[model samples]
Target: MTPKAILLHLRLPFSLFLMPVYWFSISQSPHFDVTKACWVFVIWHVLVYPASNAYNSYFDKDEGSIGGLEKPPAVDKELFTVAWAMDILAIVLSYFFVGAVFALAVLVYGLVSKSYSHTSIRLKKYPLLSWFIVGLFQGFFVYLSTQQAVLHPYNSLTNNLLPAILSSMMLWAVYPMTQIYQHEEDAKRGDRTLSLLLGIRGTFFFTASIYSLTALCFWVYLPLQQFLLFIVLTSPTLVFFLNWFRKTWLDASQANFKNTMWLNLLASFGLNALFITLLILQK
Candidate 1:
């Protein structure tokens, strides 16, 4: 693959979603090591996420738009090689920066991510299972991993379980929405994405319902001031969501790639800002 192809395969922009998890975990952590934390970020964003994206792109070979790229380039043998190489490097660096346990977690995350698109295993073919796995790994697993990486010698697995679960719930809510605009492409590949299984209207309702639940969890877990701040930060995206849902309801064409990309960018940036603000306030 050419350099452009390699960058396209990485889908680096999509890491915006993953990046917030680190901030959220570190905000809650009592112990912080800047060097270890920076290494963890590099391992996940530069290595683990890109590996997963490149591997999926290799399997899908999508001619149409894929996540984070509306016009993806053609893939070649080099894409697959680079992806697995990154995965191995991530695991190795995980061991060096964190410990054997965290390294093992990264290994398992890589395997599961590969299974999602691998022809033989193809976990993406199962809608519910695919949704659950992605939400679990990308949300809860990542949050805990970052937490552990930062607080390695001090904190236990249960230290921040509530926030991790809330993070996973939020991801579950948004996960299907990400798949909404890919119904045709996913169906062509025999992948029954969760959005397709839910249908467009059902997908919206599912997302809204889970988002409400996540909000409730935040209210319970966060201080009144912090929860209020969270609401204020998220209101703009919530309004945008309502507008987009209304437009899509009127005309399905409104649910195209351009609109979905806008939503992802808006929501991810909003959440990233919110988490960073929370981190600052905590400090």
Candidate 2:
């Protein structure tokens, strides 16, 4: 495979969509070492997430638009090689530069990601199961791991389960919307994605409900002033989502890639800004 093709297959830009999780993880950690946090970011955003994308691309090799690429480049065996190398590098770096707990987190996340697309143990084929685990892996698991990797919180888990669960809730809410535009392609490929199971309209309802619940949880958890600030900060994304949902409800065709990508961009920007503000305020 050419360098360009392999790089594109890595879908590095797609990793931006996952950044809110990184920021969420860091902000929630009880302790923050800038060095450890930076390495954690590098391990996940630079190596782990892209490797996951590459591995999946090696197997799927989609001709149509994938997550980041509008026209995806073809994949080959070397793609898997690159992915494996990245995963190995990430784990090794985590162990050396970060900590053993961080290293183990990288290992577990890598294995689970490999299973998602590997033909022998393809979790992507099961709609509900895949949906459940992807949310858990990318969200709650990420939050907890990031906290441990950076902060080594003596009580990594119970100290703040509701927030960790909120992370998962946010992911669970948005997971299917990413697939809403690809229902036909996934169906033809025999992949029963969460969006396919939900159907276009049901997907909208599900995303809105879960997202709203998460927001409400934040409302209850945060002080009145902080929650009000959140709503204010999140207005742009909220308005866009409601508008998009209304349009999609009228015509599922509105759920096309262009609109979907816009939503992803807006949501990522809003969430990142929100948490960064929170982090700064905490500091």
Candidate 3:
């Protein structure tokens, strides 16, 4: 594939949104090997995530806006080769840095991600299944994988489970909303996306409800300082969400690519900052 196509397909900038998950996992772990953690981060964001993005872009060949890109380039024949190569590299690196179990988890994540966009299985076609798979793998699985990598040879599943679950719940709450602006495009491809099934208003309400539960869980589970920090860091997104929701409610056209991108940027950057601060404080 051409460099431009590859870059666009990789959607590298979008990985910023996912890095917070890994950061959160690392922050929660009692053991932190900076070297191993860095390797894991690179493996996930550079190889694994890009592979998934390339695979999906190759299959979708989306002409309109997709996540991260307003105007995606045409897919190239070599994109598939690059994607598979990255997947293999990610698995190999995972095996060496962590162990068999961690590598297997990475392998499974890669397979699941491929299936989500692969035409044969096309897990994306099923709304509930799609939502669950994306949230579970991207949130819970990634969190666990990062924790495993950071704390290799240590058993702390009990300690780590709650944060992972909370991360997954947060992802589930936001995942469908990501598809809100893509209803027409998704429908055109005969993909009944979760957002389409929920409708615009329903998507917002569903997200709000899930987020409320997630907040409640955090309040009950997380330490007071951490919970307060979470609220403080996430407040901007809350403000933007309310403003965007109101605008969309007043004029559905406001929920287009531009506004959606603003939402993504605001949320991703805000969370990234939060997690990075947490990591620093933990250190």
Candidate 4:
């Protein structure tokens, strides 16, 4: 595959949205191991994430719109086959690094991701279900799976329940922003997205309110030591709310979309990086 195609498939920018939960796991663990963290990151980033993107691209024929891609890099007709191969390879390899259960999670996520955009069961056409599934899987499942894999035998869903739920809530808050921005295009394509159902005015309010609530939850749920750091890192999310709730909110310009997107991404990335750095320093 071409280098550009590979990079596009990696979707590094989009990965920012999920980093908080991964870092949360690291911060909360007393025996955080960098080696296992690296392995899980690779499985999630290098293989699982890329394969999901590439597979979605192949079937969506979105003219490259889905998965935060625009003008997607061209690929061979066998791209779908290659995507599936990569996914299976990643799942198999997960057993070696994170154990059988974690590997099974990979397989489950792989199937779910495939069904998301696959022609036979295109979940993307149903906006609410699509958003919910993507949020739950990419947000909650990624966090849970990463934590379980990294923490190994000691980790249990019971122990990691709070972080997993918070992660899911965080993504659920931001997921509507993507749907709002894509409303026009999706509606034109006969896709009944939640944002389209909300309409522009309603969508703006919905996204702003959800984002605000997520920020509040972050403040309430973070550890005492992390409160100040979280605030400093994630404050820009408020700007998104302000801009989104402006009186002239009907102007769904590219600049507006990019501003909200980048702001939210920065909030997530900064929080994750801060949490990870603190964990490392403490260890």
Candidate 5:
């Protein structure tokens, strides 16, 4: 109920984890209204993502570590209040500034994120279902939303399917990694994350397989030089992931918060770097 707990539970830092989707979405537009893009950024990162984090925290009330928070605060009613406040603000902002299509997208995204953690229909309990949903909404849905926000005459997904699909794949890569370190907490909450079902080694194998295929698709989709630059930009993430994978292969215990956070942050950074470069180059 305290201000500190409420603020920490908001998990605004975790918004960085999802920023690549927004960046990649805009990068595809070639040209966009900068003011609209900035508003979309504030709507998604400042309001929607933090609200989702707080809402999920309110429901889970985790005693152990969760993504972006190694020592989570005790969730209270105030957290729930703050989450709704933010969600309303996001929706209102989208409605006024971003347009109806984007506003509706925000509404749906918020509701779906709420459903992910709500007891009424906690989607997190179903490993594959939850995994797919996270990838779909956070990935494809976000790409769509970003396009809605920035494009003057929004382009249809029919044309931009590859990057939109890749956005989901990027999130799919992130989803399991976030759960790998939360096995006990997730299990305690009766949530069977894809990571738990795969087992520690299996989780890494599955992630590597998915990431490999995703990267191959990106390579095929991007121009030769762009893809090469992508590899260079993302090399640090790939290197760290491989090193972490090797360590976790030797000892599952290595898949702890410190390692998982580094993976998430580094991966986000690398992807953000690549997409932002593409965005700049497009201009």
Candidate 6:
């Protein structure tokens, strides 16, 4: 396969959406080791991500999902077969590095991701459930597994757990914006996601309420120094979020879609950078 085709198949940029959360969890854990972090990062980015993307592309047929390949060229049967083979290989190999517990985490996430796209189980058809599962896995599970892999015998939650959890909650809060952007196509495809179930105003209310709750949770859980750093790092994106909320949610347009994508990246990156900085300083 061509290099460009390989990249499209792997969906590299989409991995950015999850990497920060994973890294932060690794950095903040009490038992964290930089070496473990490196291994976990490589495993997820090289193995898990490509497997998930290959499976998603094969089933979802999301030809136009921005940040993903549109009309991804058809994979030959050999490629499809190889992808699945790698999926199993990656998850199994993870156990040697992350321990059996971490291996289970990979199994659970892999199953959920597969069900979301493949078969009649199509989890994406249900709005609230879809977002919840996506958030739970992408937001929470990624960190949980990474933490386990990097810091296997920790006694309590990692220092980074609170921050990562809070950040994940933030992503969950705004996930509807993404759903809203795809409503027209989704409805035509007979997918009734959370945005459709809640309606426009309701989506705004749901997202905003969650965002506020995340902020409150962060204040309560994070150390003052960390909290201040987080707030400072995330300020510009948070301001954008506020501005986006002040406007109408009823109109889901191309401009709004672009803005949402921008904000999502900003928020994820901002949170990631904060924790990584903390790791460096602490070291």
Higher-scoring candidate on lDDT, 3 or 5:
5
lDDT of 3 by residue, 1-283 (tens): 6798788889998887777788788877766788888888899999899889998999988999998888988887799889999999989988997677779988999999999988999998999999998999999999998887778466668877888998899789888878989999999999988889999989889998998998899899878998898899889888998998999999998878887777777777877887778788877
- Give RMSD to native, each candidate: 1.1, 1.4, 1.2, 2.6, 0.9, 2.9
lDDT of 6 by residue, 1-283 (tens): 5556655877777677667777567656765766767877877877787778877666655545534444466554444565677678777787786577777887888889888766589887887788888888877878777876777565455545676576579669867866655666678778888887887667778887997898789789878988898789989877886677666544445324566677778876887787788778767
Where does model 3 exceed 4 Å of error? Answer: none
Q: Candidate 4: worst 10 consecutive residues by lDDT?
A: 247-256
Local accuracy of candidate 2 as per-residue lDDT tens digits, 78-141: 9999999999999999999999988999999999998988889888789989988999999889
lDDT of 6: 0.72
Task: Quantify how close model 3 is to the true structure by its C-alpha RMSD in Å.
Answer: 1.2
Best by TM-score: 5
Q: Rate residue 177 of model 2 by lDDT.
A: 89
Query: What is the per-residue lDDT of model 5 for residues 76-188, given as tens digits with 9 covering 90 to 100?
Result: 78888899999999989998987888899999999999999999999999999999999999999999879878887878769889999999998887689889989998988
lDDT-sorted candidate list, best first: 5, 1, 3, 2, 6, 4
Q: Could you give candidate 4's per-residue lDDT for residues 219-274 as a string of tens digits?
A: 77776667777677666666656665673365556424555566566667777777
What's the lDDT for all of these models?
A: 0.87, 0.86, 0.86, 0.72, 0.91, 0.72
Whose TM-score is higher: candidate 2's or candidate 4's?
Answer: 2
Clashes of each: 0, 0, 0, 0, 0, 2
Clashing pairs in 5: none
| Cα TM-score per model | 0.97, 0.96, 0.96, 0.87, 0.98, 0.86
What is the full ranking by TM-score, best candidate first? 5, 1, 3, 2, 4, 6
Compose the digit string of candidate 1's lDDT tens values, residues 218-258. 99999999899889888887998899999889998887788
Task: Score residue 6 of candidate 4 by CA lDDT.
Answer: 60
